[model samples]
Target chain A: MEVNDELVDKIAALAKLEFKGEEKEAIKGDMQRILNFIDKLGEVDTEGVEPLVYMTDETLKLRADEVDQEISQDEALRNAPDKDSDYFKVPKVLKK
Target chain B: MYTSFEQVKREIENGKTVEDITRNYLETIKEKESLNAFLEVFDQDAIEQAKKVDEKLKNNTAGKLAGMVIGLKDNICYKGHAVSASSKILENFESLYSATVVERLLEEDAVIIGRLNCDEFAMGSSNEHSAYGAVKNPHDQNRVPGGSSGGSAAAVAAGLCLATLGSDTGGSIRQPASFCGVVGLKPTYGRVSRWGLIAYGSSLDQIGPLTNTVEDSALILEVIAGSDQKDSTASTKKTDAYSTASKFEGKVKIAVIKETFETDGLDPEIKKNLEERIESLKEQGHTVDYVSLDILDKLVPTYYVLSNAEASSNLSRYDGMRYGYRSERAEDLESTYVKSRTEGFGTEVKRRIMLGTFVLSAGYYDAYYSKAQKVRRIIREKTDEMLRDYDFILSPTTPKTAFEFGANDNDPVSMYLEDIFTVHSNLAGTPAISIPAGFHSNGMPYGLQIMAGSFEEKKLLGFARTLTE
Candidate 1:
């Protein structure tokens, strides 16, 4: 399938990324190649085959809900580029 | 240079302190700083830890890796230390808590010297994608130290550290280990906990060790491998005596994947080296035969589709909001997400995220993402079938030795193909190792990959030890 500019734009939008005119085109070319490469899986006979979501057959072992381990509020906000009073402050989510 | 942890301990037994060893490694790391192996060397912290270990040694309370210094792959978390998967998005971000592996290693008295550079978000075949700079091959300056564990392999190869912990998702550990001419092990998918590893492809990602010797790899795996309460996927099975266990005891059956030899673009010298190694094995009374794997070509495609899909989802958490890099251009919420991501992530990372988004997009999910999962099951079943018939399924760890810096820069597919041989183990969820086979005529070393059945690290390491011998 052709990986066109519109498709790249759509995916980039979904991915929460922006690209310049040339950057989008360059990525478009790359996605085309990658898509064509992955499209080879179309030849596989996956009939009667279950999708291998997890690597092993073992079911997820549920641990008891308890306070096991946690970092302090100070530690949680330690690396934030912008924060205030134990809150990680981002750009205002709702318009002013 | 102290080649092995055993030798490091031997010197300690001869009255040398662990502090001396740490100082010596620090000196070597300083001398070889041009290779760009270590992103940061925890000199003071390592020295403090080493001094404490010396006190432990004096009191006969030392642990398994008392004097062994190791490097983290920048992706593994170490409490209060920077662990940025070599991406600008999370540059200078300190981990709130240590990864389960780091905690285990520190408990065993291993000195974590520093974090090593790698492909941004562990996404490239060559180390060039690292935000800091490309790590040069210690053997040949112009060539790459293969990635995404490039700095880990280079660190061990250059004796910057005795060993390093690297995560393998589609050959991140093994391929770099092969390129750097060191022993790189990718234990069974659940063998080691991924509790604190920065996830790329969650299902395919596994943490393992890159070391100078197979025994060293085995030793490191012993300390770090086991189930963790934090990681539900961590194996519940009992950990094996990987370092002290009996090695391969008899002549073994080996299966050579026939398609590896026939695969186009395999370096001729690498093919010849593989043949000679097989011949040598046969001469030593081991049974070796070719095995059919019609799905050889499908491995890379399935890996890319599934891994990128997972990565796109996994990496979405890195917005301008919480920690790490935030773009100055952001004024509101949506731009905060878009501009920060576009600026923070490198080109290759963005390319992958975009590709991942395309595949998992509404219109094409079945043809790509869902179909790749079914194909993955086929790959796993076929690989397991082969392992049941033979003690080990062997192949070359890479298509060729490490290439020049800009060789495959433009063609991402060519770079993706570098992982063709090594992705098999991750796809199958089996334990595999890259043992340095020998050097090619170009004076670059190649590796032999030996894969064994799932959760059979005891036998896998034994076979690797025998093969290395």
Candidate 2:
């Protein structure tokens, strides 16, 4: 039930987001109120209830593996902010 | 401007070429650009499509939705066009492929005018969270157009488009329709394909139409609802003749949740309006009754817990490697991921992502995420039990009509509560629709919501048409 900078940092890290000092404090406060609000779900008696993952009782319909359409490499890399000839260019991950 | 698809068809039959109609709507969009309802207008593409539809009509081979111009809620994809979901993360990202809804509607000869602005990543109840700007309520410029489908609904209300497609995760479609005084239908979870929609809560989201009339909503549903191999989760059910909605006959039993009207969150004017509609239904020989949902008070909490959890998972795909905005401050892959996400996403999106991550964390997973899932089961089961005897469930779409901008900016929970009545359908996986109920004392319009059993959109639209007429 405790909300603090540590919790916010942990969550932000897990979600692949970053929060600076003042924003972190503000997010902690906002998240505290939100978490407290959602905490009201703790009142329900869910003893034997199964978690409903998918809304339907319909069994998962797996499609047979096959390629119906294929786009060219040019199209695939078209939206990348930075890209090499055929690959998306990201900042260097390792030293040569 | 036409009021419904029926009118559009009639206009075509009377020699009003689809091309002319497209131009008129484009002019309206340009005229009402101040509303910020549309993020972009596909002017040339729409005209070209309209001309093709005219040729098809001349050959008497036109498909359904001929001459009907509609807008997309930014989140739905249209190949070769930009789809931002009104977030900087995906800004200027052109869809490599069209959503199933887009393909189906285009096949049926519908003209897509443009993509409308919405909440960033379809995350907020008000369109203010949009990266572009807030969409003004067509009815009142000073107030918000309810969101995350705010622009979709506003486009329909302002006659900028005949109808629009909106992705409803919680109340995105219905709440905005209520605020804009239009008919919004969120089909059963799998009734429509989610293949092209940028994911929010994968389990909760469904694409539906916001239109000026129930008939138009039904007509659009007819074209877009069907099974798809691309989206295996899309139901294999055969499409229905939803345009026959008005032909629906016989009296139906409807239940109005007692707890909804009792809640302090409800405006007294809205309470009075919905009660009067219930009375009208009774006078029409339908059995209208009040049923208690003891868990009604907890709807928002249950919805937020489950939806945000799914959002956190669904949004992990936005790593800056492949496409979308890449932060210039990145030094390495890790910083690229963190910095791009932190800089690209809005505050609301970050807040939800953080909450989602927390709830699904190791120790808290069982307590928050799993427990909310269990609570969701209760909500769905309870709704199913109610629908067994009643053909439909009814309530005011929102507690109140549209509010002035910045009213709930300081309080996030207050904004989330606007989904109080509308989230029931998303949780229950039941098809639901919001039709114009009447105006409030403040002169802003609201909608009356009607929900039916899963895969029962035919019945839901039928009942909605009867009420709308």
Candidate 3:
């Protein structure tokens, strides 16, 4: 688990983090420690066990998908940190 | 401040109006400024609700929790309130719908006192990673309130609220509750609905109560437990009579795992106290057996891989394009996603998200995520086998008592180790609770964990109630 600066950069890109100079090494150290701990999972004998993902033993009971409540456009936009008329405004997301 | 929820409820019934209760609680929260428990206090809404509850009391329509104040961990949703998981990206985002627990609590006529602080997205062991700030232990301000449900624990511990609701993924509720000297219960997975809870690890995430006593915890559990049509993942099983279950007097068959006490790096006092507690249970006619869970060593890694993978997918919905915070300047959609996420999430969150993506990505899924899941299944099966013979599995909630802020700041591995005693229950989807067993040498609270088979919360809580008494 020798996490290098290059791997740190890649991890940062994937994670969408804005890491500075020394922070990369710090994070690298953290990652190494975590990966080392995670490595211990290899020791367990997991033969023939079904991967338990969702805990509910029963299937998700579904109802006819119906609207319980409706929020007005104005109410929806109230909490937006950045907003415009009837729309949530954001940094220009489309590029040519 | 009275620690029992019954005491608080009695005072409210005697003449203290709901308004008086909320005001006194707000004042108490202000006085205990050292405990950084709350992220946002819903002052207006709480007052309004308190007044309504007061009216209900006068009209002789008070419910079980009439005029009782409750603190909500920031992760639980409350309509018209900023329910950020103590991350900046969601700092301004108000929940559009109340979480199932919130609705149920309101129906019980409980007052929503405020939102307690938490680790970002309920991720960290200590509340230090919260953007708002870390919550200090009410017992000792220097130490952390164990997290990611630190605030809820602190609020209850400090008597700012009668009880609080928190979401537990690995051990968020129980660990913090232990650290803060409260009763924290994690119901069987799907015992409580997760409809409005912002998903952490959807499969493992469960909403439970943090209260001063196991009885209060059960009271809150009764209101919020059972199947919900809103959350498909919620169990369809009938909610049991928790209050009645709490009164069961029996010498419980308790199994204290040998490996759990034998774990390296435990505080000596915690071990002594746990042993003494086990002896006490035995003296009360309960059989205390030493069980060995050899798979205990694999808990930490399996938890991280499974939790991070599920988290990566669960959090993908938070992209600024759909809701919450957006960066001021984004050149394109990719950068918009990048900058918003970069600005919105904290360091720990980014680290987990990246690690999750890495593990689940092409060429790595089977080796990492899938392998972790397989190991998780083994842990579950082994645990089920153990529970067949024992009514409960007991352990120290944490290896050591509450540590000072920054005690493990430099070592992430050390921080992850705090979850060692608590992660197994989540992996097995069992009901677990942490009650105050004793105190550490440092004068901080120590927690004793009791876990039972899935859907055995009544039995587990019954045992916990006896021990706590």
Candidate 4:
């Protein structure tokens, strides 16, 4: 559970966040401490126990595929930080 | 200051208009502005709502919660209102629709006075992590009002509102209730619908009430708990008559978790108060015994791993392009994601997201995420077996009373340990409540936590009502 700067950077990348130099050091320490704490779960024997993904025992309710209500494109893009009249604007993913 | 639901109802019945009551709460909120309990107060909207309620009262067609003023945790959505999870990323994001709980409150004629402050994304135990700022405890300004439902508890304690709706993912509501000397309840996970609650840990999170009394908490729970088509996970099970929870008369079988009392961090005063409460319960003819939970030490760690894992996934939707704060400095799509997230999220949130991503990542998925999930099943099974025999499980809500600001800010692990007694119910998806049991020597209040089997909120509240009485 040794969370080095490289691992912290890798995790941060996956999480879509960046850390400055000093913040990275501090977070590395924090991650290591937390991981060390969580490492105790390894001691427990979970041999045949199925992982409890959901708490309730009820089966997922399926519904017919139909458009019940619709939000206009204007309403949909209301909160978008970068948007045109009918579309959300984003930086180009594919470079020339 | 107004104390109970009955008192407020009596005032309205005695010719006090709903407008008068709403105004009083607004005045109190303004007077206690230094406490930072509220993020925004809906003065005009609340007055309009109250006027309608007054009209209903005159026509003798008022709903059950007519004239009661309530506050909402910032995370719960009210259509067209800014519903930030006390995070910078969502600081300007407005809710597109009302939460099921909010809609239910409006139906019951409950006037939502304001949105209260909480931890950023409900990630931290203390309110200090909030982007708006930490909420000071009404009891002691220097100490924190325990969070992430700190403002909900403080507003109730300070008489700014009769009650507040707070979501409890892991002790968010109850811990603050304990610190503020009010009642906070976290209903069974599926008891309340999560349709418009900004998701944190979807499975662990539940919407509940923070109020001055146990009866008030029960009344709110009764109004909000039920099935919703929007939330498929919301139980199809019939909602209980929770309002009558205080009417039950029986000798309750209570089991005090032996391991909780033995914990090293438990304050001596809290321990004494809990022991006395147990004695009083026994004196009242309720059977009480000690039960061992050998996995007590593992609860906090297990909770953090599982909750953070869910949180990372749930929060991924907050990327810059969709909504919320976007970086103006981004030159590419990847930088837009990274820079927006880096600037938007606070330190604690970033720490948790990274931790979550790490555990759920390849090479460590089974070692951390899967292992924690397996342990979670064991915890749930053990709790279920105990509940089958025992009517309720009793313990201290927190190991200690509220601490001074920044006391555990640098030590996140220690702060996470504060949830030791409360997170078990969230993991098990059972109903649990925190009631003001006693005051600590430091002049702050601590609470007794009572937990029951899943969807047994009526029984749990009945026993809590009896204990509080």
Give the candidate order by descending DockQ.
2, 1, 4, 3
i-RMS of candidate 3: 1.9
Candidates' C-alpha lDDT: 0.91, 0.91, 0.85, 0.91
List the DockQ of the predictions in order.
0.86, 0.87, 0.64, 0.81
| Candidate 3, chain B, TM-score (2 decimals) | 0.98
lDDT score, candidate 1: 0.91
Where does model 4 exceed 4 Å of error? Answer: none
lDDT of 2 by residue, B79-196 (tens): 9999999999998899999999999999999999999999999999989999889999999999999999999999999999899999999999999999999999999989998999
For residues A1-96, write the lDDT of model 1, one tens digit per residue: 987877877888999999888897789889888888998999999888889887777778899999855878888889998988968888777865
For all candidates in order, state the fraction of native interface contacts they contain: 0.93, 0.89, 0.71, 0.85
Q: Which residue pairs show backbone clashes in model 4?
A: none
Candidate 3: list runs displaced more than 4 Å: A9-11, A17-20, A67-69, A93-96
Write down the worst ten-residue block by lDDT for model 2 chain B.
B239-248
lDDT of 4 by residue, B1-469 (tens): 7889899888877889999999988999999999999999999999999999999999999999997899999999998888889999998898888999999999999999989999999987779999999999999999999999999999999999999999999999999999999999999989899999999998799999999888889999999999988899899899988988765597889988899878979999899888988898889898999999899888888999989999999999888998999988877889988999899999999888888999899999999999999999999999999999999999999999999999997889999999999999998999999999888878999999999999899998888887778
- Candidate 3 lDDT, tens digit per residue, B308-412? 988888888777775788887666777777788878888888878877876887766877798898988888888888899888898889888888999988887
Scored by lDDT, model 2 comes in at 0.91
DockQ value for model 4: 0.81
Could you tell me which residue pairs clash in candidate 2? none
Q: Under the 3 Å rule for N, CA and C atoms, how many clashes does model 1 have?
A: 0
